[model samples]
Target: MTKNIKANGLNHLAISTNNMKEQIEFYTDVLGFRLVALYWMHGVEGCWHGFLEMNDSSQVAFVFNPANKDAKVEYGVTNPGHTGGPSAPGTMQHLAFNVDTLDDLLNMRDRIRSRGYNVMGPMDHGMCHSIYFQGPEDTCLEVATFGNADYPIGPKDWIDPEVQELAGISDEELAKFTNPIEFEGQGGTIPNPGYNPDSYNPDRPVQLLQGMFAMPDEQFAMIPMEKRPPSMMSDEDRAAKHAN
Candidate 1:
């Protein structure tokens, strides 16, 4: 028997920031996002974290550290600078936020322009209409709304066989990609497969990876999650101190 599980929506997108205050102002004043959280990161030393409310559950978080301030920003490596530009392989090229309606998207564009930032367009992409703009630190931003909410957009309408072949994906692979294999509940019966370099590639040292893999799941989980630094402030205290 197989079990069905999937992510519902994005909870948050954490972006590394050099200046927490500047990013906070840009996100709150220019983009109309409400500042929700600002405090020292729980586990990391000298690291400040800020969160802006996108919705009740989701937020856009910022992390600032002294080291991050000194880090150099290479246009094509650190950021794309503009929408449709190139960035490093693993780096975020651009971020797009969703709007409920086309009118809302246009209103966002107007609001951004009012904040003295130039916006690109409400361009139609067949499935959605988007307006592009720039954010602080060369961050490419976009707000979009679906062209037709009544119509369901599926892979059939968007996936092209030619592009699929160009990506070296066979028919069988494409089928599996579209419809993923279901996982059956194992009731914690399955053991760790152990470190196989071919199966898992991590940037960490071999010794570190092996030791980490050998550690018990309970111990490993607490290393990152359960840490409460001495200087850590409660969410309530932090929010009250920086009341907006």
Candidate 2:
């Protein structure tokens, strides 16, 4: 374990959608998530974003690229679907939502079924009970509850012995992996010395901000936030513009 930083829990998960209206309908109407917000996606013209919330911090966000529509769904490639197999290097395998109790897990399963979607289980895995299903855009979804409230499962119980041996983890390394140094996070501005301006990844939304961050204030402001290049839009959104 690293002592550098600590993350509490998931804030939100965003996924792409071709049609904003229909996606909103599916989340709110079918899944019973409440529409939290809908607005133009900042720094990008013609792109819209919406949020459906299960709670304040737990949200399922959507991005609609109205200008492009021809993008094909890559089953087991772009999305993991039911199988939850490996795709591209950084592909999302699946998302598991949390419930507090066994009753809640059962209720969620029933709700999913009522929405005309088949969901499997309350399959007990000792520590947690889980229900598995699929969501819009072929995203694999799971609802799980911690069955053992007193003791949360740890790596010591689950880590494979064969894999550890293959990785050549010595007893010392295994000891460190099981019990690492802890630090109490302090308040105030922490310093980062190795930060690089050129550090950018195509997968994350923060990359958009990085480009703007490198520019002068005036130039950044003058950026064509209102000008969405055709290449920037989804294929379906592009087709709708030419519909005559």
Candidate 3:
């Protein structure tokens, strides 16, 4: 029998940024999200992480790395440039956040415009109405509100057969994709099957990768636990760091 486990919703969504301060301002000041956590990213050198609260449990996080400043952004490659455009495969084409109602969506649109940024949409997309805008560092932002229906989105009705054919998904493949099988529990019976160099490929050097795979999971967990939160740091400790 499959274990009774499922993921309910998002805990947070992390986006990489070169300018943490600018991203923080856009999320908090303009979008009215509360600043919750700001600290030096654990296990990473010279990186800063900030979180803007989306709800009590979920947040929108940004990571700032100095190396990103040297990276170039080519529209349609780095970013789509708008809500509907092309981006490199595996990249986040756009991020759409959820709101409760149409009124809330419009109010957010007004708030963004008041901050001197142009927003497009309040355009209806059948199941939801959305507003599109640009954020710092060519980030495409969207806010949407689902319609007040018993089942706001019907996947069966929404999935087009022609589009499915174009994507080369057969009936069996579509059924499997839509409804995935639940995993049976192993009850901690699996052994560490130590790393294999031939089977695995890493972008970084094998020596560096081997060192990481060699460490016990329990020992690695302590590395992040050593760093305290930004708010808890003392004056002398604060001087050694930079986070806004």
Q: Per-residue alpha-carbon lDDT of model 2 for 133-201, expressed as tens digits?
A: 877777778888886444467785767789999999987899887887676565533433332557743
Which ten contiguous residues of candidate 1 have the minimum total lDDT?
A: 224-233
Q: Say what the RMSD of model 2 is.
A: 7.6
Please write out the lDDT profile of model 1 over residues 7-41, one tens digit for every residue: 76989999999878889999999888999778777
The better candidate by lDDT, 2 or 3, is 3
Between the candidate structures 1 and 2, which one is better when assessed by lDDT? 1
Number of the top-ranking candidate, with lDDT as the measure: 3
CA displacement after TM-score superposition, residue 47 of candidate 3 (Å): 0.8
TM-score of each: 0.84, 0.70, 0.84
- What is the full ranking by lDDT, best candidate first? 3, 1, 2
Candidate 1 wrongly placed segments (more than 4 Å): 1-3, 147-152, 185-191, 199-202, 224-244
lDDT of 2 at 194: 33
Model 1 residue 126 distance off true place after TM-score fit, in angstroms: 0.3
- Model 1, residue 145: distance off in Å is 1.0
Ranking by TM-score: 1, 3, 2
Enumerate residue pairs that collide in model 3.
none
